[model samples]
Target: MKLRHAMVCSSNQNRSMEAHSLLKRQGFDVSSYGTGAHVKLPGPSLREPNVYEFGTPYKHMYDDLRRKDPELYKRNGILPMLKRNSSVKTAPQRWQENAADGCFDVVFTFEEKVFDMVIEDLNNREHKLMKSVLIINLDVKDNHEEAAIGAKLALDLCQELEAVDCWEDAIDDIVAAFEKQHKRKLLYSISFY
Candidate 1:
C-alpha cells in the first residue's frame, strides 16, 4: 500500500511545497501545511510585511502582491512560486488549528520549530490515531535553493520506504537509513553550494 505523507514548514510557500510536489510526482498521497500564525513573506519595502491568513486564496494574495508591487514580486520570484503553489489542493494551514484527519502515515517537518509544533499538536490533541503517525524532522532551511535540496533528500527517503512492504515493522531501519542519507546529503550540499 502507498504510504500517506504530510510535509510541514514555517511557510507553505517554499520548503513544504517543494516536498509536497516531489512526493506527489512520485505517486504518494501527500499534503503540505505551514505551522506559522500567518503566511509571511518579503514585501516590496523593508517595512512592508506580506502577511496572509490560512484561508486566504492563493490567487488573491498573488494578485494583491502583483498589483501592490509588481517589480518586487517578479524580482524575488515570488510571483511564479505563488502561481505554482496555488495549484496545490489546499491553502496554508496551521498544524494546531486543523482538525485531526488521521490520514497521514508519516509527517516530515523541514525545521525544528515546525517539528516541535507538530509534536505539541499531536500530544495535546485527544485523538489517539495521531500516536501511530511517524514524525521525522529534517533540518532544512527555508529558501528556494534549500527547499529544492531538501525535496530531493525527502524523495530519496520516501523511495527507500516505498520498497518495504511492512512500514511499521521497518520504520526504525528506515529512519536510520534516512538520517544517514540526510547527513550525507547535507555535507554534499554544503560542498556543492
Candidate 2:
C-alpha cells in the first residue's frame, strides 16, 4: 500500500511542525496543522530557520528552539538525519490553508483536545471511506511547562519518524505519558473499518 497524505494536528503547531518535517525525510508524504487557526507565534517568536552551516534539521529546530526558549532545547538535544535538508518548521498560514481542505489519509493529533475534535469531526462527516484517525497524546503545549517536555517531545517525534513506515506505528512507540515513550502497539492496536 502506498501510504501518502498524512496530517499531524496539535493545539499549537510546534511539535506537529517537527513531525511533518521528519516524516517527509522518511519518504512519507505529510502535512500539519493547529486546532486554532493561529497565524503566527504569539510573542518572542523564533526567527525563520536558516540552514546551519552543516545542513541538518536538528540544528535548525534546536537552534530555533534555543533562541526562542533556551532552557527547553537545552534539556533535549536535536538529531538530524544527516542527509535530510532542514525545513523551516511549519508556518502558521501554511497549516491553516492546507487543513481547511481537510484531505488527509491519516490524521494524528498530538494534543488531547485536538485529538477528540478531529475524531468527532471525522465521524460526523459520514464519508467513512478508508481513513483512520488517532489520538497520540504528547505534551505539545509545554513551552510553558519548563519548555523541556515540549522540546523533548519534538526531538523524539523526529526520531520516531526516522524509521517508521506508517503513521499509526510511529505513534505506538510513544508511551501513554505526556513525555516519555515506549514501544507497545506497533500498529497492532489499529485496524481500519
Q: What overall lDDT goes with each candidate model?
A: 0.71, 0.47
Instruction: State every prediction's TM-score relative to the real structure.
Output: 0.84, 0.49
| Residue-by-residue lDDT tens digits, candidate 2, 1-193 | 2444666666653466556665666666776666664323333335743222212234444456567766543443322321121353423333334554555555556656776666655555555455564434443443434233443444454445444567566554443432334432211123232
Angstrom error at residue 131, model 1: 5.7
As for candidate 1, its clashing pairs are none
Please name the candidate that would achieve the greatest lDDT relative to the true structure: 1
Minimal lDDT window, size 10, model 1 = 184-193
In angstroms, the error of model 2 at 80 is: 15
Cand. 1 TM to true fold: 0.84
Give one digit per residue, the lDDT tens place, for model 1 in 37-123: 888878867698799998787788889999988988988888887887888755676666663554566677777767777777776
